[model samples]
Target chain A: MSRLIRGNAVSADDWTELDDATAVPSTAKVIVSLARWRAERETLAAATAIGVRVDNSADIQTLWPELRDLPLVALEFPKSGDGRAFSQARLLREHCGYQGEIRAIGDVQRDHLQAMQRCGFDAFVPRDDQDLDDCLRALHEFDLAYQRAARDDLPLVWRLRRQA
Target chain B: MYRYDEYDQKLVDERVAQFRDQTRRFLAGQLGEDEFRALRLRNGLYIQRFAPMLRIAIPYGLLSAAQMRMLAHIARKYDKGYGHFTTRQNIQFNWPKLPEVPDLLADLATVQMHAIQTSGNCIRNITADHLAGVANDELVDPRPYCELTRQWSSFHPEFNWLPRKFKFAFSASLNDRAATRVHDIGVHLVKNDAGELGYTIYVGGGLGRMPMLGHKIREFLPEVDLFSYLEAILRIYNLQGRRDNIHRARIKVLVKALGPEKFIELVEAEWAQIKDSYLKLLPQDIERMKGRFDVPAYVDETAADDGSYTAKLAADSKFAAWAKRNLRAHVRPGYAAVFVSLKANGVAPGDVTDAQMDALADLAEQYSFSELRATHDQNLVLADVARKDMYALWQRLSELGLATPNIGLLTDLICCPGLDFCSLANAGSIGVAQDIFDRFEDFDYQHDIGEIKLKMSGCMNGCGHHTVGHIGILGVDKSGEEWYQVTLGGSAENDAALGDRTGPSFSRADIAPAIEKIIQVYLEQRDGAEESFLHTYRRVGMGPFKARLYAKVSAETEVAA
Candidate 1:
C-alpha cells in the first residue's frame, strides 16, 4: 500500500486509482484518467466521490467548468525534475478557484513536499522508496515564505512589512 | 546599496539552515548522489574540475565594505586565497570543499549574503547596470527593481525547477551597460507617454551554442505590474518550455519555436488573470523598495575642486593616462566613479587575491561611500570618488597593482575560468588571455587600438560572453587537443550583435599571433583615430580583416608545398 499524506498527517487512503484500461467499479471511491472521465462522464456522473487524474501538460483552464464539482484533482509528475505540475496545481487553485483536494501523484519525493504544499497540493502520494515520516517533516521545512501563493493565510512578508 | 531587512535576513538564514540539514542527510547516506547534486546545485555548490566551486551572489553587483571584508575572509579561509568575479557580476570560490559548503553558506548569512539560486536549472542571480545610480546618462536607477525581482525570485516555489537556468538583467541608461539584450529576461526601466515610470520588457535573450538576442515582448509594462507579469512569463515558460533536450531547453528556444507573438499572447493572457492579485505592487510598495536605495550622503562638491586635479594632470602624464582610462563620468559634479581594473598584467582576469580584496575593501571605505560595485566586465567600481582624491586613489590602487590603465582597451578582456578550473572548458582561456595581455603590454598601442571588447569562452557555453565581444575567441577541442576560434565585430552594448567567425580555428601556439594579425588589419583599415574598432568593422564589413587573417596561412601552406 502507498503512503498518502493528507494535509499535515499521513492518513489512510480510501480512493482507488484506476488506469485507462481498468473498468470502474460503480460504488467505489475511484479516481480515473481525464481521458476515461471524458469518455464515461455520463456513466461516472451518478457515482459519488469520484476524482480525475490529469497529466501536467493538460491545460487546467479546460477543466475549470468541472473543477467545482470534483472532490479531488490529481496532477502527475512523471519525473521529479519535471515541475510543470507545480504550475498546473497553482493554476487549478489560483485561477480555476479549485477548492477540492489537489493530489501529487507520480515520482513525488520528500524534497518537493514543501514547495508542493505552497503550490496548493494538500494530498501527496509519495514514491514507495521515500519514508513517509521524513516526507511529512519536509512539508514544514520552511515556516515563512517571501511571496503569497495559493495558501493565502500564510504571510506575505513584504506586504506584512507595510502594515508593520 | 540596498541593505537586507529582517525578512530578507530571515529568508537567507532559513535557506542556509535548510541546506545544512540537506548536506547532513547526504553525508549520512540517506540521499543518493543524483539527489544530493540537485539540492547542492541550487545552493551554488558545484563539483567542478578538482574541487567544489561555490558561487556567491552579489545581488546587482553591489557589495558593502563589510561584505567585501567577509568575501576576503572567505577567500583566505575557504578558497585558495583568491576569488574570480564572473561576467554575471557574482564571485566564485573555486576550491570549496563539498562537506564544508554548508558552513561557508552559514558564514555568508551573517553578512546578508547567500548562494541560493546562483546555479541549477532555476533563476540565477539578477544583474543590473553596474553604473546604476552614478552614471550621468541613466534616466532612473535600476537596482531597486533588480532587488525587488531578486526577492521575488528567491526560492520561488514554482520556478525553482525551470527547464534550464534563467538570467535577468536590467538597464535604465541610454547605453546598455548591463548587456540587457542577451539575458533570459531583460528589463529596461522606461517612461511612457505620460512620463510615468514603466518597463520595456525583452524576453528569450541568451548566449550559448545558440546565441540569440532578446525580442521585445512588451513595450510598456506599468511599474506596479512587474511581479505579476514576470510570474505570467515564468509560468508559461515553466509549463511549456522544452525539457527533453538540454541544449534546447532555454527560454530562447521556446520563444523561437512559438514565434514572439504567440509567446506574448500567452503571457498576456496569464497576466490578465493575476494582475490585481496579491503580487500587484501598490504605490507604497514601490516607495518602500525605492526608499532603501536613496542616494548616499554625497558631499557638496560644487566648490570642492581646488584646481589640484587639473594641476596634477598637467604635472604627471602617468596620472593623466590613468585618469583618462580609469575615471568615469558621475552625475554629481566634482565627483567621479573609479574603475579598479582587475585586468592587471600576469594575473588572471577577474581574480583578486585575498590581500588585494582586503586592501580594496579598505580603499572602498576611504574613497567611495563604503560601497563597491562589480562590473560585468570582470572589474570593481568605487562609484563615488571625489575628483580631488583621484590622484591619491590612483596612487594607492597603483601600489596595490590594481590600476592597469586599461579599462575598455583590448587588454581589459572578459574571460571565463576555462580549462584550468571549469570541467566544461575545452581549452585554457586564462593562458590565451595572458598571451594577448603580454602582446599588448604597450599602453600606447592599446590606447590607439581604442575600445575593443575582446571576450573569450572555453566552450560554447559562452560564459565569457564571447558571442557579444567586439573580437570574440572561443576554445574548442579537436581530437583531445585545444584549438581556439575567433569571431569579429560582435558587441554587447546598445547595438548588440553576435560576432562573425573569422575563418578556421588556430592552435594554442598561433592564437596570439592570429590576434596580432587581426589588430594589424584593423589598424591598417580603420578610417582614422576618431573611428572606433566597431565603427570601422561595421563600415568595412569583415572583408579586409578576413582576407588578412587567412592570407598568411595560405602563403605558409604554399611555401610548405
Candidate 2:
C-alpha cells in the first residue's frame, strides 16, 4: 500500500487496482488496465465507482468519448525517467475535458510532484519508500509559473497585466 | 541584452538553492548516480572525460560588458583560467569539480546568468543570428523573440523531460547566420502580404547520428500564435516520439516516421484545442517583451565624413586587408560590426583566456555600445562599432593576437572539443584543426583561395556542425588509429544542404593534403575568383574533386614506393 496525496491532503485511498485476470467487483472503487476496461466497458462502466489505468505507450486519445465519465483516470510512469504521462495528463484535461480525479501512479517521486500537478494530476500515489510530507512539500517548490496549467487558469503574463 | 526582472531573478535564485540541495543529497548518498545525473544535467552540468563541464547560457549570444567580466571572473575562480564558446552560443567550463558546481551556479546567477537547460533533454539555449539587430538586411530584430522563447521554455512543466534534446533557432535576416534550417525547430520571421509580421515555422531538423533538414510546416504563423503553436508541436512530439531507442528518439525521427502531412495534421488538432487558451500571446505581451530589447541610442552621423577611414584604409595595406575580412556592413550609417577572431593560429578555435576575455570586455565598452555577441562561428562581435574607431580597435586587437584576419577563411574552422575533452569523441579534433592551421598559415594564400568554411567533428554527433560545412571532415576510428572522412558542397545558409561524402577516408597525416588537393581542384576548375568554393563545387559537381583527391593519394603512394 502507498500513501495517496489528493489535492493537497493525505487521503485514505479506497480505490483498488485490479489486474486483467481479476474479476470486476460491482460495489467497490476498482481501477483496471486500459485493455481490461476496453474489453469489459459495459460491465466496468456500470460499477458504483470505477477508474482506468493507462500505460505510457497507450494511445490516450482513444480513451476519450468512450471512457469520459470515469470517476478517476490514473496515468502510469513506468520509470522515473519516462515522461509520457505528463503529455497524457495534459491531453486528458485540455483535449478530452475530463475533470475527474487524475492520479499519477507507478514510480512517482517527490521531484515529479510539482510537474505532475501542473499537468492536471489531482492525486499522486508516490513510490512506497518516499515520505508523504516530503512529497507534499514538493508541490510548493515554485510560487509562480509562466505557463497556464490545470491549477492556474491564467498564465503569469496575463496575471501580471491585470495586477499592473 | 535582456535584463532579468525580479520574477526572473527569483526563479534563478530558487533554482540555485534547489540544485545545492540536490548536490548535497547526491554527495551524502541519499540519491543514486543515475538519479543525480538527470538532476545535474537539467542544470547544465555534464560529466565529460577529463572533468565536469558546465555550459553557461548566453541567451541568444547577447552579453553586456558586466556579464563578460563575470564570465572572466568565473573562469579564473572556478576551473582552468579559460572557457570555450560553443556553436549554440553558450560557453563551457571544462574543469569544474563536482562538489563545487552548486557554488559555481550560484556565482553565475549573481550576474543574471545560469546554466539551466544548457544541456540535457530540454529546449537548449535559443540561438539567434550574431548580427541580429545591427545587420543591414535584417527584417526584424530576433532578440525579442529569442528572449520570449527562452522564458517560455525555461523549466517548462510538460516539455522539460523530452524524449530527446530540443534546439530552437530564430533568424530574421536575408542571410541565415543562425543556421535555422539545421535546428530542431527553426523560426524565420517573415512579413505577410498585408505587411503583418509572422513566422515561417520549420520542424524536425537536427544533426547527430542522423542529420536531416527541418521541413517547413507552417508558411506563415501569425506572431500572436507563437507560443500556442510551439506548445502544440512539443506536446505531440513528447507523446509520439520514439522512446524505445535513444538514437531514434529526436523529433526528427518521429516527424520522419509519420510523414510531414500526418505530423502537421496532429499538430493542427492539438493547436485547435489550445489556440484560444491563455497560452496565446496578447498584443500587450508582445509589446512588453519587445520593450525589453530597447535599441541602443545612436548619434546621427553622416557618411560623408568617412574620408579619414578611407585614407587610413588606403595608406595601410595590412589595415585594408583586415578591414576587408573582419568588418561587416551595419544597419546604421558610419558604423561597422567588428568580428574579433578567436581562431588565432595555436589556440583552440573558440577557447579564450581569462585575460583575453577581460580585454575583450574592456574593448567592448570602449568601442562598441558596451555590448558584445558570441557568434555561432566561435568568435566575438562588437556589433555597433563606429567606422572611425576601426583603426584603433584593429591595432588593439592585433596587439592581443586577436587580429587574425581569417574570418570565413579555410583556417577559420569550427571544431568540437573532441577526445581530449569529450568522452563521446572517437578522436581528437583540435589536433587536426591545428595541423590544418599550420598547413594554411599564409595570409596571402588564404586570401587567394577565398571564403571556405571547414568544419570538423570528432564523432558522428556533429557538434562542430561538420555535416553543413563547405569542406566537412568527420573523424573516425578504424581499429585504434584516427582516420578522417571528408565531404563536399554542404552549406548552412539559406540554401542549406547536407554534405555528400567524398571518395575514401584518409589517415590523419593525409587529411590536410586531401583538403589541399580538393582546394587545388576548385582553384583549377573555378571560372573566376568570384566563385566561392561551395559555388564552384555546386556548379561543376563533386566528380572532378573526388577524382583528383583519390588519384593524388594513389600517385603519392606509388612515388613513395
Q: Residue-wise lDDT of candidate 1 within A32-135, one digit each (tens)? A: 99888889988877666789999888889987786668899999999868899999999999888888899999988898888988998999999888889999
Q: Per-residue lDDT tens digits of candidate 1, residues B195-282?
A: 9999999999989999999999999999999999999999999999999999999999999999999999999999999999889898
Question: Model 1 clash pairs?
Answer: none
Q: How well is candidate 2 docked (DockQ)?
A: 0.59
Best by TM-score: 1
Compared with the true structure, what per-residue lDDT tens digits does model 2 show for residues B133-167? Answer: 99988999998988889988988889988898999
lDDT of 2 by residue, A75-128 (tens): 998887678899889888877888899989998887778888998999999888
lDDT of 1 at B506: 93
| i-RMSD of model 1 (Å, 1 decimal) | 0.9
TM-score of chain B of 2: 0.98
Docking class of 1: medium
Weakest 10 consecutive residues, lDDT, candidate 2 chain B?
A: B298-307
Choose the strongest candidate by lDDT: 1
Off by over 4 Å in 2: A23-27, A41-48, A153-158, B302-307, B552-561
| Fraction of native A-B contacts kept, per candidate | 0.59, 0.43
Q: Which model scores highest in DockQ? A: 1
